[model samples]
Target chain A: MAYELYYWDGIQGRGEFVRLALEEAGAEYIDVARQSGHAMGTGAMLELMKSKHEPHIPFAPPFLKDGDLIVSHVANILFYLGPKLGLAPPDEKLRYVANGLQLTITDLVAEVHDTHHPIATSLYYADQKDEAKARSAAFIKERIPKFLGYFEQVLQQNPGGPTHIVGDKLSHVDLSLFQVIEGLRYAFPKAMKTYMSNYPGLTALRDTVGKRPNIAAYLRSDRRLAFNEDGIFRHYPELDLAP
Target chain B: MAYELYYWDGIQGRGEFVRLALEEAGAEYIDVARQSGHAMGTGAMLELMKSKHEPHIPFAPPFLKDGDLIVSHVANILFYLGPKLGLAPPDEKLRYVANGLQLTITDLVAEVHDTHHPIATSLYYADQKDEAKARSAAFIKERIPKFLGYFEQVLQQNPGGPTHIVGDKLSHVDLSLFQVIEGLRYAFPKAMKTYMSNYPGLTALRDTVGKRPNIAAYLRSDRRLAFNEDGIFRHYPELDLAP
Candidate 1:
């Protein structure tokens, strides 16, 4: 049976991270909420999140239902998928490292989300323009460098070579990092232009992941959602650093 | 060999989540940064984070060194510790559920941290007080209820019972949740005071976790750092909701 993935249909958001892993591994899965004319639509996603019968309840969307088990939180879902999808290291020590990297990526994604919604997730960008401007400034100057630089160093020092983020293999983290670079570029093209040159290894990995047969196919396919103002990595002329 | 935990000497911050598991299990471990008269001190913590030789690099503190393995990120650290400490369930499926809950708690902690520093982590709280006040107001009204209420639903719906977060057993998620409630109360006594009665299940779990023999002893001991302005959960009279 194909694994069922639940997420909003409109944008990639956090769901795209999981989608990248599934695509990378060539794993059979159904993008439940995103499917066209499906019996279980967006409401099904909410039902699963609010489902009381399930042993685990997802606090939000982008959860995975793998036969008997349901997993939530992007990093946590990736943790379960990484091993099965051949995208994570078999060595226990290296697996933990992959997890740490994924969690940190989750952290970066949250900060990126905050740039668009600095004051409150409940509030609109138009309502919090000044706050988003201040947030985007710091995020571009400080957080982006700190996070991307750490990954750059990790890639530089990788004993197995910088082919992947964990050991010598293409782990889930590599896919997630690919997504991070993609999202950041889409959201803050001008701001990232100043910093991208410093992260050659990351840029290289992003390029490689994008060209992977499965990922390349998916990118060209209609399944891949375009980045927009409604998504986590949003572009606003004002939020983007001035040219 | 004792498992070595590296974190700052002061403030519970994120480290306390991992520390809680160690204490609850009465596990043999050394608080590396807290040990006095040692050459390592806090410098060792920074050294590890900056270490070029290690395969895994922690972006910040609260990392664990277990023999040859190194793990970082609070939830990631707990994911490693939970099973070893017997705080998590023996079942594999249940373990992932526990991890999902733990990651959600991590999300809440980030919001709590941002309440005091909405603009930038590089800037002081005073530098961003106006932004913080706006952030905190929304957080108290929205985030606290949303996170706490979701956890309450988890507890109330637990198959094993309401006492624990996963499979009727005390997992690392439970200990982390206890810390969440404790830190929030210490940091937002006024805001929490109004919402406390609404989350009796969570408050009860916190109280129960505190009274656990090992935890009870740890709380009274100096090892458990007091909540302060420097930590993730900080209490400023102005930030807290007024009586």
Candidate 2:
């Protein structure tokens, strides 16, 4: 059976990370919540979540259903799918390293989300614009350098090669990194334009991943959602700082 | 070889989650940063982090070193250690479920940290007091209930029983959940006083875990650090709403 991906429709959000990997491997999967029909769509996704009988209930969306098993969390989903999709290193040890790297990306993504919703996720962005400005300023100045610098260092120091994040091949970490770079560029075009030159390895990897035959095709397809304010990586001009 | 755990000294932050598991299993390990030797201590931890030759550089503290392998991130470390320490499910399928639950706890822990430092980790609590207040209000009202409710439901619905989180036995996720409840009570005593009644399974699990011989001994020993302002859970009266 094809995998069922349950995430909120319209916005890419965290689901984009999973979608990127599936797209890269050309895996057979259904974007369940995106389907417009009875017994499908966002309502179906919520029904699974709110179901009392469901044993392994996910705390939130972006969960993947494979047969009777349900995997939640982007990194967890990627870890489970990586080996099956042939998007992970052959070495078992290196797979853990890939997972650790993906978890770091997860941390960075959470920080990025907080840049706009500094005060409260329940509150509108306008309600906490002042806090968002303060958070975004610090995020641009300190966090971006710290996180992106760490990734750059990892890429530069990888034994396999600078082209890949883990072993000497394309893995899910690279795809997620590619998506992160794309999101950051979209959200902070001004800042990234100045900062992109600092991380040459990351920049080259992002470019290489973008040019991949499947990824290139996916980018042109309607399945790849555009970055918007509703997504995790939102381009609020006021939050974008020139580094 | 004894496992080497590196985390910043002085408080029970993320490291506490790791510590709880080790303590429960009676695993022999060294708290690297807390040691006061010439070649050890926080300086040594920094040296390892700054070492360009180290292939698997951890992004932050709370990383575990065993032999030549290094595991980072609370959830990742627990996932790796769970099987070794016999703190995970015996069945392979249930292990994935255990990991998913642990990841959800990880998300909740990050949110709890942000209740005090909503703006930026670089900024002191005093600097972000106003934003923290706003964030904590929403956290107490919506997030706490949501996260705690999910866990409570999981425990209540567990096929094994309400005592354990994953299978029929104690797991790292249960230990982590115990620590979370303890931290929340310390950080928001007033709010938790009113909200504790809502999560019966969690509350009972916390009590059960605390009563365990090893955990009881660890709590009484100097190894378990007290919760304070320096830790993720801080008791700021202003931020603790009467929920």
Candidate 3:
């Protein structure tokens, strides 16, 4: 059976990470919430989320249903799918390393989300713009450099070489890193413009993942959603600072 | 050999989650940052974090070193340690479920941290008290109930029953959940006073885990740090509004 991906339809959000992995490996999967028809769409996704029968009720979306098993959280989903999709390192230990790197990406993404919604997710962005501005300033100045620089160093120091994040293989960590760099560049073009040049290894990795035949095709496909204000990576001109 | 746990010495923070799991399992581990001696303490921890040779340099602390392998992130470390410490479900599939639950807790903990430092982690709480108040209001009114309620439902709906979060075993998920409840109650006693009644399953789980012999002992020991302003969960009377 094809894998069922349950995420809110529209912006890529966290689901994009899973989509990139699936697409890269040419795996059969359904973007369940994006499909149109009976028993499809966001209703189906929400229904599963609220379903009392689901023994493993996910706290949020972007969960994967492989047969009867449901895997939630981006890093957890990737850890489970990586080996099967051939998007992970062959060594068992390196796989854990990949998962750790993916979790680091998860932390960075959460911080990015908070930049635009500093006061409260319940409040309008307009109401919290002041807080957002301060948060974004700190995020741009401190966090982006800390996280991306750590990743850059990791890439440069990779035993297999700087070609991939773990071992010699182009694992899901690389794909997620590629997506993160893309999202950051889109969300903070001004800040990233100055900061991007500092991390040459990450820049090369981003380019390599983007140019992958499947990823290149996927990027052009309708299935790939554009980054918007509603997504994890939002571009508000005022929040974008100079590094 | 003892498992080496590295995190900030003073605050419970994220490290408490891992500590709870280890304590419950009676696992022999060194709290490296808290230890006093040559080749120990926070300096040694920082040295390893910036070590040029470590292929897997953890993005931050609360990382565990097992022999030569280093595992980072609370959930990742627990996932790696779970089986070895006999604190995870025996079923391989349920291990993922436990991990997913642990990751959800991770998300909740991050949100809790933000309630006290909404504007920026670099800035002191005094500098962003206004933003923190607004954020904490929403957190107490919306996020706490939402997250805790979800966990309550998951526990009640567990196939193994409400005794544990995953399977019939007392897993790391249970230990983490216990810490979350403890933290929330400490942080927002007023809000949780009303909210606690609605989550009897979680409340019971918290109590059960607390009464467990090892956990009870650990709580009385000096090893368990007290919750303070420096920790993830902080009690600011202004932020702890009535639910």
TM-score of chain A of each: 0.96, 0.99, 0.98
True contacts kept of 2: 0.74
Tell me how many clashing residue pairs each candidate has: 1, 0, 0
How much lDDT does candidate 2 score?
A: 0.92
Q: Is candidate 1 or candidate 2 better by lDDT?
A: 2
TM of each candidate vs. truth: 0.97, 0.99, 0.99
* Per-residue lDDT over A162-221 for candidate 1, one digit per residue giving the tens place of the 0 to 100 score: 877779979889999999999999999997888889989999999999999999999999
Which docking class does model 3 fall in? high
> What is the per-residue lDDT of model 1 for residues B139-168, given as tens digits with 9 covering 90 to 100?
998889899989999998888899997887
Error of 3 at A93 (Å): 1.3
Reference-based TM-score, model 2:
0.99
RMSD of each: 1.4, 0.9, 0.8
DockQ of 1: 0.82
User: Which residue pairs come into collision in candidate 2?
Assistant: none
DockQ winner: 3
1 or 3: which has the higher DockQ?
3
Reference A-B contact fraction recovered by candidate 3: 0.84
Question: Candidate 1 - CAPRI tier?
Answer: high
User: In model 2, which runs have C-alpha deviations exceeding 4 angstroms?
Assistant: none
Arranged by TM-score with the best first, the candidates are 3, 2, 1
Please give the C-alpha DockQ score of model 2.
0.82
- Report iRMS (Å) of candidate 3: 0.8
